[model samples]
Structure formats: C-alpha cells, structure tokens
Target: MLHVNARGMKCPWPALRAARAMREADAILIEADDPIAPSELEALAQQQGWDFAALDACRFSLRRAA
Candidate 1:
C-alpha cells in the first residue's frame, strides 16, 4: 500500500498529496492530523469514483475502483 503522510498539514495539502499518490498506487493510506482531512478526502474519493474508509479521525484509506 502507498502511504501519504499528510499529518499536521493544512487544508488542501492532504488532499493534494493523496491525489499525487493515487497516480502511482491503486490503494493508499493517508495520515493527517487536520480536522478537515476526512471530509476533504471524502470529496476527493467521490470525485474520482473511488472507495474511502476512515481508519480514524485522522487517518484514511482510499482505493481505486476496480
């Protein structure tokens, strides 16, 4: 699994990093301390038609559609 370390990042940064990682991996685990991280990533996943699961309030896993 690809890992995107977005912990402590500000708004948009976590989403940007996750998007970049998606280019190279079908699945990715992202860790972000930002309170908005989950929602932002949920939006991204919807836009991309992917699957999104929150491992925690600050962590998420995104997977591309098969």
Candidate 2:
C-alpha cells in the first residue's frame, strides 16, 4: 500500500495527493490531520468508486472497489 503523510497539509492538497497516488497504487493509507480532509477524502473515494475506511481520527485508508 502506498502511504501518504498529509499530516500538515491543508485541504485539497491532501485529497489531491491521494488522488494522484491512486493512479499508481491499488491501495493507499493517508494520515491527514486537516480539519476538512476527511470529508474531501470520503468524497474522492465515492467519486472514484473506492472503498474508504477511517482507521482513526486522523488516519484513513482507500482501496480499490471490488
């Protein structure tokens, strides 16, 4: 799995990076503390048809829908 550390990144950036990374990997783990990252990521996953899982308050994972 690709690990994306967006802990300090702001909104859109974390989601952007995760979207970009998705092209190269089937699964990705993201650590984003931005207040809006969760919503953005969830939207992205929905739009892309990926499985979204919130590992914790600041950690999330995305996997290809199967």
Candidate 3:
C-alpha cells in the first residue's frame, strides 16, 4: 500500500498526488486535513473503479475495486 500525506494541503495537490501514485499502486492511504479531501478522493476512487473508505475525520483509504 502506498501512503500519501496531503494534510494541510490544498485542493488538487492531494488528488494529484494520489492520482500519481495510483498509476503504480492499487491501494493507498491518504491523510489530509482539507474538509473536501474525502469527497474529492472518493470521487476519484469511484471514477477509477476503486474503493474508498473513511478512516477518520481526516484520514481515508483507497483501493482498487475488488
């Protein structure tokens, strides 16, 4: 699993980083403080046919659909 720290990061940064890593890995754990992080990431995961789950208020996990 890949780990990405997008905490305190702005929009697109987190999503872009995650998208970059997704090219190499099927699963990733993202940590972000951005309120929209979850929703944005969730949309990306869905678009990629991956699974998205909330780990906490500022943490989430994404994995290839299984």
lDDT of each: 0.94, 0.96, 0.88
List runs of model 2 lying over 4 Å from the truth: none
Q: What is the TM-score of each predicted model, taking all chains together?
A: 0.96, 0.97, 0.92
- The superposed Cα distance between candidate 3 and the true structure at residue 49, in angstroms, equals 0.6
Question: Model 3, range 1-66, lDDT digits (tens) per residue?
Answer: 999999889887888888998899989998988887888999998898889999999888989887
Candidate with the greatest lDDT versus the true structure: 2
C-alpha-based local distance difference test score of model 2: 0.96
Cα shift from native, residue 1, model 2 (Å): 0.8
lDDT of 1 by residue, 1-66 (tens): 998899889989999999999999999999999988899999999999999999988889999988
Which 10-residue window of candidate 3 scores lowest in summed lDDT? 10-19
Which candidate number maximizes TM-score?
2
Candidate order, TM-score descending: 2, 1, 3
Number of clashing pairs per prediction, in order:
0, 0, 0
Give a tens-digit lDDT track for model 2, residues 1-66.
Answer: 999999999999999999999999999999999989999999999999999999999999999998
